[model samples]
Target: MTMTIKKQNRAAFLGAIALTLAWGPALSFAESVDDKIARAMSAAPSDVSAEATIMDVDGTILREGTNDWVCLPGVGLIPGDEHPMCNDAVWMKWMAAVGAGTEFSTDVIGVSYMLQGDAMVNNDNPMATDPNDGGVWVQDGPHIMMLFPNMDMLADLPRDPFAGGPYVMWGETPLAHVMVPIEAK
Candidate 1:
């Protein structure tokens, strides 16, 4: 009987380790800059206006709203239009989170979305310009998505022709923005 119990314990420990190894990396990867933006936008509520800008590593605007801007690195800035992927639920969550006051900053090429700014409810860290505090914040082909808290503030609004849906927030901040990765052209 003792032998059987020991065997079971050993099996359980090994199983736990294996499970962690398999899912740990994927979870870490999902915390990337692109995933952060996608998740934030995915949790946003519909009807809340927001804008996003996507740029390449060199700060070049690859694709802008209705009109693609000149690919001038560190020169041009593009605005995000209504993305088909940005559903109503996503908009609501993001807006609500922002309204609730959550300051967020992410690493452009790394994992871990740090909470920063006066809006942050849990972690009241201020936004810093340091490389550790600032992520890539790019919007190029590798970008997944980039959402803003106040998109309705735009002068010339873009078109959003998608049906409304439910917004869901997973973490503490619902209004945080994200950046997704796409196939590099």
Candidate 2:
């Protein structure tokens, strides 16, 4: 009876330790907005001469920059099918450095410039009623903007006030904006 009890206690202690070790990385993955922004900026190109700015929920500018892409770090940009707008290669690199594992939803604003290939394609998601088609394609110029919400104030506001505008414009030609959510490894 004594030997059995000793073995059970040892097993329980080892299990607890194993569980903590496995979850340690995930616990550290919950990063702050500032950390994410810094990571994104570090990955961005220095010679492009673009700017990055982070805004608060009240429309106040928290941080601004003069660089290639203005990123909100962990935020996503949704592009419509009509006018795809973004460099996928560059975006992928940025997300990778920021320790992926973030969730971003698409909010399509509107459909301007009625061209032949500019018609919005509906992916049949009723929640996305806007003509922008919820970030399906890249040709749809600056349609998607990443949102960084103030967690404390978000619950009290009647509507979502964290709607963010585009930070980076992918040159002259508006390709498709692809906001791929990265999972933290």
Candidate 3:
């Protein structure tokens, strides 16, 4: 009996070691800053000048720019998804506020373009299947998001994601924005 137990323990230990070794790269994987920028830039129009500033997904300014447009890499939302976005300066400022978890209100309207979205994520509870007013997920491709200063911007827009129209995201929060799904080309 003692020998059997010892053999089982050794086998378990070896399996654990093998699993850890297999996950080594995934555990330590961090996208390079340059690669992040490139991926993020792919979300923008090719006509965008090289002068646009590149910002980290964490809101850190990677590169300063003279243009009002700001670009950022994917922030790792959902699983197996990479949805990068290009934002105007106002949107970038708003993004910073959102990342800081602070309440911020502004009347200035702004626009962001996402030309390479992998999948749409639930704006409220990321992991929850309920409380989703904008359906569950978007099955489309590139899209644009608009930040409204107030309810007026909503303009009676449907909150349904499958409405084949614009919908409000983060409707339960003060940072609500209109999500406009674009047909993939």
TM-scores for all candidates: the values are 0.21, 0.23, 0.68
Query: Top model by lDDT, which number?
Result: 3
lDDT order of candidates, best first?
3, 2, 1
Which residue window of length 10 is worst by lDDT in model 1? Answer: 68-77
Clashes of each: 32, 24, 0
lDDT of the structure predicted as candidate 1: 0.25
Write the candidate numbers in order of decreasing TM-score.
3, 2, 1
Strongest candidate by TM-score: 3
Which residue window of length 10 is worst by lDDT in model 2?
A: 109-118
Give candidate 2 regions above 4 Å deviation: 1-33, 48-51, 55-60, 67-69, 76-185
Q: Please, what are the lDDT tens digits per residue for candidate 3 over residues 78-98?
A: 333456778774565455454
**Model 3's lDDT to the true fold?**
0.59
The true-versus-predicted C-alpha distance at residue 105 of model 3, in Å, is 1.6
TM-score of 2: 0.23
Scored by lDDT, model 2 comes in at 0.27
Q: Write down the lDDT of every candidate, Cα atoms only.
A: 0.25, 0.27, 0.59
**Candidate 1 vs 2: which has more TM-score:** 2
| Model 3 RMSD in angstroms | 15.8
